[model samples]
Each structure stands twice: as C-alpha cells, then as structure tokens.
Target: MQKRSVILAYILWLFLGQLGIHRFYTGRTGSGIIQLILGAAGWATTGILIGWFPLFVLWIWLVIDIFLIPGMCRNPE
Candidate 1:
C-alpha cells in the first residue's frame, strides 16, 4: 500500500489554503508559490468577496487533489 498525502493536503487546503500550504504539502512547490502569491494579491487588492473566486477554485482543486495525491505517492520499484 502506498502512503497517501491526500488527507494532509485536504486539511491544509481547508485551513491554510489561502497561503497555498496544501500545495506545499503535496510536493507542488511551484504551484504552491503561485497560489500563495495569487491568493495574497487577490486578498490584498480585492478583499474576500472578489478574492473568493480563486479560493473557490483552490477548494475544488483540493477536492480533486484528494484522488490524485494517493496515486502520486505510490511507491515504484
């Protein structure tokens, strides 16, 4: 059985998603950085209501990520 990163990622997504913490937890450093920047910029520039769209997308992305992280974590030998 493979060790899954999904649960951890989901938790981060649920809580620290605006900081892109979930992406970092999932080993997607580049995307994490991007999300962090976008999220921050959006919040700073537009406030929560306008910034929410990307956050919503991130939420959906996190949900989808739950199915993917486990597979990506599968050990190959």
Candidate 2:
C-alpha cells in the first residue's frame, strides 16, 4: 500500500482541481467524473453565459478541498 503525497495532491488540486484530477489521484473516481463534467460544462458554456453556476459550485468545492487534501492524501480510498 503506497501512500499518497500531500504535496503532489496539493499541486494537482491547485492546477487541475476544478476538473477533480486531484480527486482521481486520491481514488475518488465517482466525484472525479462529476467534477470533470461540471468543469467541462463550465468551460464549454461560459461563452454563452450558462456555465457560471457550475463554475461557482466548483470554486466553492475547490476551496473546501484546501483542507481536505491532506486527509485525501492519507486515505485515498
């Protein structure tokens, strides 16, 4: 059982978090897919002005993740 790295988790969370890449790295595949869809929709619809809602939700989730990353790195299950 390899341990996940807090630093790497944080890095992914910072760079690719909105798409839930960090979650995927921590083995949270279901949430990762949901976040991926939300992020994709946010980017794809931003131009037409329908994406802001999901983006806002994702932004809040990412903020919450700031503290969650450490636990995620530890468990990753």
Candidate 3:
C-alpha cells in the first residue's frame, strides 16, 4: 500500500473537511460521501431556523476527526 501523509490529510481536513475532502484523501470514500451529504445539507438549510443543527453536528464530527487522523493515516492491512 502507498504511504499516506498525515500533514496533507490534516491540511485537507482543516481546509476542506466540511466537504469531506480529508476523508476522501485518506481513502475513506463511504464516510466521505456521508460527510459530503451532511455538509451540503448543512449549507443548504442554513437559511432556515433549524439549519444550524447539521452544521453543529458537522463541527463535532470534524473535531472528533482530529483524534482519528493518525489512525486513518495507517496503512491498510
């Protein structure tokens, strides 16, 4: 397997994580798509009164990802 760069992954996570870019970069396509959908939903509904909820969840998810990145960078068996 190819080596993954934690720095680059974190960079993606920092800049484009709302769109699930970091997850995609780390070879996690499924969760990436889910994040993407959630992000889009968050953005799409932001104008509504209840829209902030998805964004809030997304924030928590991203913060949790900060801890998961090292494990994500590990090579697959």
Clashes of each: 0, 0, 0
Q: In terms of lDDT, which candidate is strongest? A: 2
Greater-lDDT candidate between 2 and 3: 2
lDDT of 2 by residue, 41-68 (tens): 9999999999999999999989998998
Task: Please write out the lDDT profile of model 1 over residues 1-77, one tens digit for every residue.
Answer: 43546667567777887787866765668878987887777677565477777667766766686676565445311
Q: Residue 8, candidate 3: how far off, in angstroms?
A: 0.1
Q: What is the lDDT of candidate 2?
A: 0.91
lDDT, ranked from best to worst: 2, 3, 1
- Using all chains and alpha carbons, the TM-scores for the candidates as numbered come to 0.61, 0.94, 0.91
Top candidate when judged by TM-score against the true structure: 2
The alpha-carbon lDDT assigned to residue 56 of candidate 2 equals: 93
Please estimate how well model 3 matches the true structure, expressed as its whole-model Cα lDDT: 0.88
User: Between candidates 2 and 3, which one is better according to TM-score?
Assistant: 2
RMSD of each: 4.1, 0.9, 1.4
Ten contiguous residues with the weakest lDDT in model 1 = 68-77
Q: Which stretches of candidate 1 lie over 4 Å from their true place?
A: 1-4, 47-77
* Candidate 3 displacement at residue 18 in angstroms: 0.3
